[model samples]
Target: MGDILIVDDERDIRELVADILEDEGYTCRKAANSGECMAEVEKEPPSLMILDIWLKDSDMDGIDILKIAKRDYPGMPVIIISGHGNIEIAVAAIKQGAYDYIEKPFNIDQLMVVIGRAMETSRLRRENVELRRRDVEPPELIGNSPAFRTLKSSLEKVTKSNGRVMLTGPAGSGKELAARYIHANSGRAEHPFVTVGAAAIEPERMEEVLFGRESPERGIEPGLLEQADNGVLFFDEVADMPLGTQSKILRVLVDQTFTRVGGTEKVRVDIRVISSTNRDLTQLAADGIFRQELFHRLAVVPIDVPSLDDRREDIPELASFFLQMFNRQQGLPLRTLSEEATTLLQTTIWPGNIRQLKNMMERVLILSGGKGEIAAAELPGPDAAPADDQGRVVLSGSLATLPLREARELFEREYLLTQINRFGGNISRTASFVGMERSALHRKLKSLGVVTSSKQGARIAHLDEQPAG
Candidate 1:
């Protein structure tokens, strides 16, 4: 049921074992010496290894290779076989991490039984690691707003199919949540759902991280791509991936195969890639920054996740969900948001989207203490400002009465809002006018709670149109 590598210098013995394993419904690869054995392991880690301890005409004997395999891939089970057997050799092999040592004249039934037990033991060890890794429950997509409903509907429609999905939206807008939702409902739900933060990894190590690495000193290290085999691989902020790494990823998407760094053997995988980005990938492709072919391969079904501002109606529901979730997680008594507090949240602008809202709820709960109900005063940031007829904040001498920090914040909020409106809510033009980088201005506007109109957001989304081939 799993791949097994057989290593022995005797050609006849290797073939006999291969034939037996193939008949038993287990995939098998035979190696005549240490070179081939290590090569096979580096190319793709096997589920179990059948190694001959007496490897002739090899630089590293079976025991030497066993140490490296055990050091690098602790999960894989290795069974050492030897023609010349002794108590000391058996004890040495076991000490070096061999699952079991078998003498040459081993009984067929005994060998099969040992293999079965070793496979089961490997499976249990993997499940144990997975359980610890997934102790936190998967995130749920929580909201009932029209925008939220549309996004949820789109995600549901694509679950049965394995189309590569590209989620486009602002940072902290629940793209990863939507990605996890798709993987959980898809056909590959039983397999792994591995995520690679494209921008978070350093450029120098991107290839090694995504494609894996192999070296004489370090042995073999499996990459994220191989880990996501037969499952979903989610790339967060894919636009930030380095150019060289992008090219390598494109090859993997096209051929479903890749080689680890410092290795020549190609390893294949079955994966469904789902990439997310806040930046416009199509524009980058056209500008020759991101590869054009890679864009097409990744954006087979592009879905835009709405910013929190577009889903203000869901604030009360989302707020309550976070509060309840926190209560369960922390073993604290349930708390409720006051009517005024809910209204304040719905009216306020969220630059960081759903993530920011979740964090704010947690902060409120921690500061609420013994209080059962959270009030408007407990909420972070200033209350929603009164807007004049022209949609500008009406200061009304509030600036003079407020502290220096609040007064500066108030002026910046009104100033940025006026400029944003004057520029037709175009973030790029406003950033240019304000002498700031587009990213910095975006962050500044978010901090000031300045909301951009749907039309401007639409214009930004328009940049994702596929370039002419």
Candidate 2:
């Protein structure tokens, strides 16, 4: 049992949790609203704080309170209780410093489980944060491989000019990070930098978000490319852009001018386009999937982001950085990974690459029992818990006995394909189910050349002759 604070405008909710935790042998404090929440924390901060995002008449929303508490008491763990919104806000909350969030009308057991995990995670983050540093430097291309060195030399040459640049890489290979480095290394580091992951957005309003548009429907304004004038317009997963948006982008790439959506007047902006994707744009063009002209315009100097497997040497540095990040975030006793854990970390095939590794570290930081060191069991399994599908099963096995990286890749390819089959190849459903955007998934399919069931003919014929990832 730990000291906890329950903050909500609803008396029933506050009372229910206060009563429950108290009965469970925890010292529980109740706050009828945010004012009381502020007052209560000031009185004596608890080990954990449970926050409800919305309330009947609270002075502050949960996100607001979360920011306050996170800033005021960086060590305090906050578990958000979202009533109306979904996990988008929850993920946003996490990015903004909330420990974790439970949906409204949560099962008591699940809430308790999340709470416990959040507390532990908070403790561990605080313990290991010193090992990691918030990335703020210009892209320092760090690799010794000849392939990487050639990439570095290419980057240097590109940074000398302001041409439309396109980058290619597998998912989680750090395209965006590389884009930023390009901006930072370029002469326009002082200008506004904007990024758009086209696949993450809905196709219906893609134009409005990208080019510029007036929408009475959403009371929205013009788009970002105009806003990023004199700077870079980074189109992430460019191959995922809708056909209409792709045409418009192609026009811009060619002429650096475009008529604002819903307007007749053509607007001109001095913007450098930096497009990145994991897909083969040429193949996409040939397959009638993307605009060939756009490919030629953006791919003037194409660069590839190296996968984590290719940079095994960077694992220790990256892990050290994450450990320190969790140390500050979790507030647990400072600890380091044992040699066994370190060895396991290096060998695992990161199908999801760096992004997966980061989440894995977070999971481990939370699951570890406050021990200074993290063990293999404490880490997240190879796969992320499928977000949109309940039946999704992570391909699991012994990490030590298997070739970690190759096994992970095999598992992911199969898992993603399985999800695709389950969703009947509805890319959006599959992407959401797998916690990515439709465009990203499209790019993945384009990059991997994964087969649909109809095309899997001979491969699916035997039932066991599936594509080896």
Candidate 3:
């Protein structure tokens, strides 16, 4: 339920409106004069305020309250009501922070429309507040490997500026999560961190989602960028955005102002942007699939996330972390990874990075479903080949056979392919079984150029496979 305050000197009008608002699912609180209204406002701010222009007191007007609320509260929305409404006064009221004005001898339908619009705005505002609260609750960014440490330090710098960021990484490398850390740590932490993942959103309708639509019946509303004013707009899978959209978004980056889809007047904003893409954008630009200028604009401080296999040593820690997390979430015993499981986890190449490790532990827990002493047989698949005492792969081949990095890469690629096939190319199930984020797994498949298409979504079945026809 929403908290709403109604202020009017007319007793009949006050009761009638309060009863009507209560019926409409609003928690209605009433005040007979401006004095009481201000007192109620100070006690605790209501979600929406319904104020009558005329009052018993002669000192101030309802428009004065709207101006005061707007100036002090900044984003709070207010609706004005009056028996003395006219076109000129309505326009003036709007200019003075009145969200909308309604004529008294109130039409309940029209009032509902105005209230609905006000409530929507309030809800978005409240959510933005809660999001900011959650963001500031401290660093949830986990990891300590050199790669992770490097990324973490870079993030501190990224959060210190209004500069745009281009997060380039394989899927599930926590690019979005990293972006959140940036925002949460930034000056815009109190503002919204709105996200629109380009790959997740269909290409054909990207415009509507970003800018928004306007039907005559629905009224002219703001878009995502506008909603994110004084905040950050995080675009995930920005590489998947169509070339035309890239140019359009580039224009917004250059000039922080845009008209709504069917609008004429420019709606300006002061916002920061942080975007991510798993694809090689420079190559995409070279191939004419992405705009070079747009890439140049967005890559103000580019962050490249190393693949999971690149940070093999961090696996044991990440696995234990995920296990601890799951243990708490599932309210189960504090289960430790077996020496076998730890070695198995360490030796396997994580195509999906930390996201992959998390998934693996979850599968172990689910398979164990909170049972004791997880064994290699309890694992979803066969033990690592040429197993160590812990059942993890122990490479017997000489380092001379392949460079250390190359051998590691080969091992990880082969291991991921085997797991994918073992799971029948089911990305989510494989992710759960292996311990990785599903998007990270999908990204791993894409980066590995693995292709396994079913009637459902496609995935990488082999690291050496090509993109689909």
Candidate 4:
């Protein structure tokens, strides 16, 4: 829908192509050499480029321009045209990322067809990204407590604008969920809503995963930035992102462009960023662990998600919601929480917030064993021993009277469960705390016959599948 730049040294040839394209209802621009071509592109990237592989009296040739364009503006389709085209040159152009190659004396009809196909191909790629994003169900922001209502009101107000948002909250407090809610409600709802788990991805592969990589061996793998074009890019636990990557992300925020990991050309994107963090970014920035400029850019519309402790009144509703969700998802029988059981849930300390509550509800439903009403006695009790200032639970129980094997099993189960609860049911953190591999911990839990709902089992299986560090 934008201008198409035709690059060639010869005045007549450039004018002819421009005139034909103009007649075909495409706005046309002309560039006589590589320098002019790049200038025009930098000024305003055209939807497509018609490039000449040979340029006379120009500091750089058409092939050089093609390389730069493909590297930087990878999404923009480029058609290489050469007057003295050969098989090798054509192959080279295509390998360098050109959409197609056309020899001199090109057929007018064929040229139009290629142009149409190239533009359509680009459009379809974007549409595919959006479609894939739509396949993911948006997370619901459920709750009617004053804390939750105020949070929803703030989210509704911010969704009307394109301001960058930074969600601050404790782990599992629904920051990522809040970010998704904003994206799903925003004007860019129809586009992709890509998430980058800052802590989940290994540091070595972070750049490649975020900015993508392009090489002859690897071909082209678009990064999260490109996939999130015209949509939202949510950074989960942004404080976990490395400082070096933080600076690069900051540059992208400032310039709206970035080069891939193995690329030299800049890839421009239109994206709205929403980042969430459980850590104190202000203190981190002051300590130089996080970039101050980047933090300010991300926190333009800072919003704090209330912890589960702050909204205990929502527990009964939230518990019921999770119970129904798990039942429907797993095709299990309907179950209800007794008033006493509900009261117990409300009184318990939910260190993991909504996610912990959800997991606990799933466990309760699984353990209910077809009972229509879950009892207070069925629920797992809150932490047995008060955690010291260092968060280490000191158990005050004796297994001296029990047999060795029985005592060992009981101790292991209690210790593991306590540690798991301490870390808010994050298996990875719990594994790290207990000095066990994630898979090993899962196997241990299974061997101990610790009952887990299907959803928790799936999550454990997913964690087990990841390669060990």
Candidate 5:
């Protein structure tokens, strides 16, 4: 739970709300005027705010404060309170992004219900942001190879410039990781780090998704640009963006402002754009598939992420890191890779790059039953193969000697992996094949330390072909 900010000119009403909220186990702050409100907001942002629309004796009205608050903290949920009970004013407050409106002489029960719902919305929104961060942001840049070192050096310079960066690399080649590293080192590290997958968004709703909409039914909704104000906005697979959306994004970079769909109010954002693509943007611009001016704008600082094949020296260390990470995440016993296993890992070409390596390591840990040592035979082929028709695992090393419990767990893990690979890493299809709900299968995979990315052709650990018994 987070603290609540209550803004009202009436001291008694403020105190009453504060007491009620405090009794409900919420920390409440009182603001009598716009000055106090802004000062409190600057000191520390509240999770949800309650503002009285008719603030008598205040230099700035409630609507003015609401506008400023929404502009500064677009994600914060706000509830407007008014003594007059004017519907028009309430509608206006919603237009300014209020979560809900309450008339004065309000029922306390209703107020509490609204407050609960608003706080939950705020909590969920924050959780969504955190999940996005976890999904895209790497724990750290995990390599000391020569190629990695050179890329890190270039990133250090780019971080300081705050110019639009264009990261080009193959699929799963750590472009997003590099973008995150830049954001982590830059001045905007404390602020939001938002990632938008340009290729994932529907082309028809691209404008509405990026710039938001001012709908008569849904009120004013802030877009990704406003959500990422004063922070880094990462555009992943940016070359796939529609031409019209590219032009709008270009306009934002050039003018530092954009009008929402069906809106005249230009929203100004102090954002640092970092765009990445696996495709050749230069060639796309040449083909007129992408806007030429947008490419030039985004490519002000171009970086090429090295493929895993080029950075094989980092393989052992990356393998160790993922081993430790999944061990902690899954509460599995710590396991170390043998010298032979490390050598084998380095020899392979990772076409899917770092992500493939990560997924493979996780799969190995789950299937190995947290055995003390990871031998070379426990790992799948460098280019992981598909499971055979009967879905039987090819036992290597000494699985027969393991304890019954560990052996069963390992067998179940292999079965799931085989099913997932059978479906081409499609969780829904895999769930159907396994006779389990999709979400339940996902939880099972997650619990077993299996990691699958939504990217096309992401690697899934599979068993080698074997003759039938």
Candidate 6:
């Protein structure tokens, strides 16, 4: 049950392979030039590609396409076919990542055998990727509120189709988790689920990272698009992707295929894209930072995840869920929150949404030793400043002895770290509050040697106590 694409400039050859392969119980498709071949591949990558060495009226020759295909879909098998085959060209093709070579007047039995072998290789590689993939527990939405109910209903509809989804929400509002939930319930659940942070990838290397790269000597290095073939690709912070890269991604969304970096062959992929961003994409588009057309394509089925404050009724359930989950994972004793503490949690402004609550619970569990009920008095709050006995800000060492630039750097780092920790490592929230661009904030954090927590373990340090009456 494999799909095979046969690429040959000659009409006779195209028909012959299509007829032969279809008779052999494999789904067969044919293309006349390099463009057609790549178009088919990008729309829905075949298990194997049979390519000609010299493609007439094509942008690139067979060997060139082979290298690009191999790079974009490393596990995909390609068999080189040539009427003008020689030892030198065959050896070169093999070196450039072809699985095997076939001569123009080849035996039917031999070609079928090679096709079977190549299909088997592709199957085995995909199986290996699946086997090595981590079996992570799906994140729970954990809410009984009206807003949550509507969200669940909408998600169910979205999962039934293969439409591109745009998730817009505040940081730590479970956009990635919602995307995962949709993937888990979709038809492609058995396939790979790859995630890429658009902001994290540098603009210079963004193409190579997302679309992959090809080299005659190095073969092909598959990109995230190929890796997410037949499954889901979640792009976190998609608004931060460079404008040029956004255009390339738009092409992929439009045609379901892309050419790799330094290669002319189009690599096809069958992936459902789900992009998320905490920023206002519309505003960014108006400001000319983000592409408006790309935004529209990504927002075909926009879903806005509610902030924690909007769904306060679900706080108790979420808190208890996280408490139990942490207990099991950390091997801590069972714990419960006191009534006063629970009330305080529900009333406070959860700036970092569910993520902040999870962080607070983790901190509380650790601080309370996890054996008994957690009291309101023991909880830590958002503020992160150490004051002296005279109520003055405390500075480590002697600031006056240091140079102005060095002192300023130290203060900036401290301030950013404090705000980041207070917001439970929510970069978007911190950026907005600090009046800095999110990308700029990221650069600053990287330069300052600050590594933020992963989305799964994002934490907001809590206050000492709240006015829980």
Highest TM-score against the true fold, candidate: 1
How far off is residue 91 in model 2, in Å? 36
Q: For residues 1-469, write the lDDT of model 1, one tens digit per residue.
A: 8999999999988888889878999999989988889999999999999999988888999899999999999999999899899878887888788888899977778888879767855764575367436624655888765677789999999988999999999999999889988888888888888888776566886887778876543356577788889999899899989998888898998899999999889999999999999998889999999999999999999999998877765688889999998889886558899988876686577899899999999988777685678888788865466666897877667576999998897777766765564344567877886789999987776665565773443121133342323
Q: How close is candidate 1 to the true structure, as a TM-score?
A: 0.58
Q: Residue by residue across 24-137, what tens digits does model 2's lDDT show?
A: 787988887778889999999888998888866777888888888888998888888867867578677776676666777888998876676556544434432421232244
For all predictions, the C-alpha RMSD in Å is 16.1, 17.3, 12.7, 18.2, 14.8, 17.7
- Candidate 6 local lDDT, residue 329: 85
Q: What lDDT tens digits, residue by residue, belong to model 6 across residues 224-311? A: 7898999998999998899888888999999999999999988989999999999999999999999999999999999989888666
Clashes of 5: 0
TM-scores for every candidate against the unseen true structure = 0.58, 0.52, 0.56, 0.56, 0.57, 0.55
Higher-TM-score candidate among 2 and 6?
Answer: 6
Residue-by-residue lDDT tens digits, candidate 3, 238-351 = 888888778878888888877677766777889898889889889999999999998898898999876665455466677777778877778656677776766566556567
- Which candidate model has the greater TM-score, 1 or 3? 1
**What lDDT score is found at residue 45 in candidate 2?**
88
lDDT of 5 by residue, 369-427 (tens): 85788998898884443346697655545677889888876777776755454334567
For lDDT, candidate 3 versus 4, the one ahead is 4
Model 5 local distance difference test score: 0.81
Off by over 4 Å in 5: 1-128, 131-138, 382-469
Candidate 4 lDDT tens digits, 1-469: 5579999999999899888989888999999977788899999988899999889889898788888888898888999888899888887887888888899989989999889767755654555456456547766888876678878999998997999999999988999778878987889988888878788666766787789878754367687889899999989889999988998999999999999988999999999999999899999999999999999999999998988876665788888888888878897667888988875676577889899998888887776686778887788877545568898966555766778899888888766654554343567876886799999988888776553332121122245544344
Q: 245 in model 1: Cα distance from truth in Å?
A: 0.9
lDDT scores in order: 0.82, 0.71, 0.75, 0.81, 0.81, 0.81
What global local distance difference test value does model 6 have?
0.81
Task: Candidate 2: list runs displaced more than 4 Å.
Answer: 1-150, 214-220, 328-334, 380-469
